[model samples]
Target: MARPVWSGTLTFGLVSLPVQMFTATDSHTVRFHQLQRGTSDRVRNKRVNERTGEEVPLDEVVKAFDDGDEYVLVEPEELDDIAPGRSRTLEITGFVDLRDVEPIFFDRTYFLGPKGKEYTKVYALLEKALGEAGAAGIATFVMRNHQYLVAVRAEAGLLTLHTLHWADEIRDPRREIDNLPGRTKVTDRELKMARQLVDTLRIDWKPEDFHDTYQERVTALIEAKRTGKSVEKAEPPAESTNVVDLMDALRASVDRAKKPSDQPSGHGGKKRANSGDTSPPTHIRDAAAKRRSGGGGRRKGGGAGSSKGASLDTLTKAELYRRATEASVPGRSSMNRGELVDALRGARQHRATS
Candidate 1:
């Protein structure tokens, strides 16, 4: 095992156990440094003086703060001395039901384990207690010299600690968003149809069922570019679709979800005719074809012309993420789908380049 970055203890009045903190999470993808296109040699970066176009020595550089006009330079070493350090202990302040904590506050997750054989019993006790209570312990711990709020809870037989963002860090939705529908004047028939459609498509979260098709497409694009193959642009869907009478669409969607797709014939992806003139009704064909195109049309917000009725489920996860990147949605920097899903889709499409 590698050496821990910090050594600490979980203190909860009369119960203390030694613990160690290891660097959690890693970049699975390989990293590379920028270099000149023609050469394999490392491209060195020179420290250039901003005012004068000349190289500056590293030792002469100092930290500076700007007041939107002028900069006040301070000795770099002063920053180290002035900045306070976290006390380096996972001090439990209290416990709260895990459900009560909003998803916005969560930042990063880490695992906490007993430091030695002697501390195992106390560690197990804390884990069991938290698990039984269906609660998470709110604790403070120092990692990389900064104090952070962490939620310590038990999962998979180990104590897992999730670092949290401050409450003030989350932006208010009311500020950026305006002119949204209040009650959405949906008809009872439509609501019933929508509910029935949701039921037909319900399935367990089999993660394998989902894959980053965008990433796969991107990989294919990179390979095509490398091999000098023509990267054909996909045809865009028609300019528009109507949004009125969603109930009729919902009714069709329920039937589509319930019906199994026709078996494939030996003819490249063609459906074998169980019955003549049986081209899956127009709506079903459109929905399935959209899936094969990797939902390019949905990402562009043109759902066959229904400008006001774009849906997040209309696109795949990868398409949604691509739109999020293009839209430059806020906090998309750290959002996981379960929380960011439907909300982020519309947000990204409408958000400005802030």
Candidate 2:
């Protein structure tokens, strides 16, 4: 069992449960020390006085705040003196429906366990009450000199606390997003096909089913190198073509989803980070360049004189998203229709110029 990182009283009304907070998750990323290339010596970091060019002792290091032309040095003891409180307590402010909080606001999570055998009953009672009510308790607490907004809820048989970002910390999409969709319409048949595709591929989430293949490949590479073995290189996936119709792509995706797991869907396998290919694949760039050169063929039953540039502005949200996907626009998944159009147009122009 992991040791508790923090111990505090969880208070609500007249009830106070003495609990210990243990981190619920941990990163498994491999760590490497900085070293000089071709040398066995490891690099080290040091703190020094900027003006004097002298190494500064840890005890002598004081944090300073810039105030225009001068600086105010503050001692570590001064920070402790102005801390929230002497007694550590996570006081519940109010209960709220769990659905009210968006997933984006959540940060780190911790598990709450009874500090002593005597506190188990109260802890279980609180967990059960929150679980039955289908609600989470909003609370504020201080830890490591930082105040955190948190949501406490029941998970499995234990209480879990998720640290949340303050309301002011969340950026307003209206201000940050310039090209938001105005009014876009989707054909009933297209919408139906899209839903069918989603329904066909949907499955219960099993985290264990997915593994970090890149990390595994990296480990294998290191092992092979140590044993004096050369690893074979794998081919990259082909780039997607510019989509002329949304319904056609959705239909093809649905068919692929229905196919057996062993069969390939023409598209390449996911590119692993260990592959060391930083630039976008050649096929994607080529395809984007082709699209930018007015390679979009005439729509079925349409004349060759049809305006391809003007047609882009009249595309549905689904069609715009498909184009954005082909162009590999970052964060395109969350963008609105107009934003997708703007990004796709910019990507096309960039591909053409570059």
Candidate 3:
């Protein structure tokens, strides 16, 4: 069973629906404690007074809210006193087009379902109504002593609640973009090549397709470090990637994006790391080149179809994943490699008809 982090009733108009909130995301960053170089003991964080150098207990900490221009220190109990509702309810004051709400307003998301099995009908009814209208229920629900601008929308077969950020929280892009020049006009040739490049690189966007590449590389690096491997520093890529001629560079980039088999593929390739979590693109290219030279083909005849068949069906799902790593497919760690063989097959068939 899943745990509810917050319990409250969702209220909009006369309808009051009970609900619970749970976290929608998790982090897997490796944690390390500060440790002395020669000792087995771990280091501890301490809060000490700068002047007196006295250690402070955790309970001694207090949050200070900025009141106007001054800092107003308040106690925990005081915050509890101001908790959003004496009677738990989400109040929907108004509704607006989803497009009207800028992306900056979105903060977090949570799944909202009927609080109990008894509210099943109500849940379905709400989900259906929201779906048909193509409208997100703009509502405010109090959770964890604070009120949140939450968008209630039905996804798949369930109610999903997305928490929105307050207007004050969003940084003004114009402030950072100050003094930016107006757009430069492009020639017909430049525009044509640019569009061609974009179309060539375009692919169906599935959130699961990509991953935290830097994280995976970092993890690999850490593992390599633990194994006592050394990493060499690399020279940087060309500083002036801006081309002398726009259309010519775009044409070159498009051709380079293709696979050696003459297939019009995107800018995706394998990479190799020096016993660390991070691998360089150049290293991956080098490895691929070396493999191609040592063995004429990974399959029979060096034909596209035969090579794909060998690559796809040569091994089980795990083997395909290994091959994909050899191919430098992104987000490999987050995948159940064996299951992907069936998935890729289905995806390919679907794409062919569509």
Candidate 4:
């Protein structure tokens, strides 16, 4: 079992349970260290006085609040003295329906566990009650010198705490978004087709059915580079069909969804070929056929003419990136200009032989 990051008492009106909080999630992103080019020296960051150009010691640093014409310096000891005193307690104010809280307000989540063997019974009781009621407790607590408004609920047989954003922190989208679709007319036929398309595509919610292809590709690229193996650029994706008619597009979508597709749905990819879709209008059908016939050929976005012998040294980073995108080069997003050149060249060579 992993050790909890926080240990505190969770309290209601009169009941209190000794609980510990564990992180619910972790990021799987690839990380890199800064280094000087053409050398193995690691890059170092130093805090220095702006005017004197001298490195400053960590102990000498003091946080300051900026005013219009002056700055007010604050000491760590002073902040500690005035910080919220309920650091060891998570006091629940009230219980409310979980659905009443919007998802946008959620920031981070943590798993709440019983601190000791004696608290297990009480913890289970609270979890059961919350699960049955479909409610969560709203509470305020201080952690790491910062106060947070949070919701506590039961999930997956464990009590969970989710930090929520303050009301003033959430911005109204309407203020920034222009030309809102206040009212739009939709014909019965269009609505019916849209619903049919949704129904045809709907399936049981399965979290395991999806995987992060981009991250996988990135990992592959890193491994290949380390092993001194060749990298291949992927073919550019197809352009979506541009239809002016809403009803026609929905119908076509429904027909496309019904057919088996090679592209992964998890990555938002569509069918590569509509093998037997004939329900669409004659023009649409002709366009689909043309797309299928030219599937193996160069796409407009793929930079098709850049073959194996093409010189990548003279190309700009953006052009190299485009070629990498076409070839589905893994971890290409993070590669530097020189790395991209090397990867693109290797990809082209691999494609020529295969």
Off by over 4 Å in 4: 234-245, 260-354
Q: Tell me which of candidates 2 and 4 scores higher on lDDT.
A: 4
Ten-residue stretch with the least lDDT total in model 4: 271-280
lDDT of 3: 0.61
Error of 2 at 216 (Å): 1.3
The global C-alpha lDDT for each of the candidates, from Candidate 1 onward, is 0.62, 0.71, 0.61, 0.73
lDDT of 1 at 186: 71
Instruction: Count clashes in each candidate, considering only residues at least 3 apart in sequence or on different chains.
Output: 5, 0, 9, 4
Off by over 4 Å in 2: 177-184, 232-241, 261-354
Per residue, candidate 2 scores C-alpha lDDT tens digits across 118-233 of: 99999999999999999999998888767889999999989999999999999998899988775767779988998997777665454543465456556767788999998644
lDDT of 4 by residue, 116-234 (tens): 99999999999999999999999998887788999999898999999999999999888978877768677798789989998776665545444554566678799999999976553
RMSD of 4: 9.7
Model 2 error, position 148 (Å): 0.3
Which of the numbered candidates is closest to the native, going by highest lDDT?
A: 4
Give candidate 2's error at residue 7 in angstroms: 1.4
- In the range 1-354, model 3's lDDT, one tens digit per residue, is 689777678776788778877777787776777889999888887898788999978898787888799999988777777766742676666656666777778878787767899878887888888787777888876665577888887778887888898778787777879776558677898888788867765555555545664466467678879999864232334233233434545655555444322422123532221122222233234334444466344435543213344556454443344344444444443544334565566656766999
**Model 1 Cα lDDT, one tens digit per residue, 1-354:** 867766778888778888877666664443458888999878878999889989998888777889889998877455545443335467888999999999989988777878999889999998899889999989886654366888988887888888898788788887878876767687787778888977765654544334343444456667899899966443234222235425445665675445432322122232211211112234544554555467646535446322234466554333343344434444332333433466574665556553
State residue 108's C-alpha deviation in candidate 3, in Å. Answer: 1.7
Q: Please, what is the TM-score per model?
A: 0.62, 0.70, 0.68, 0.71
Better of 2 and 4 by TM-score: 4
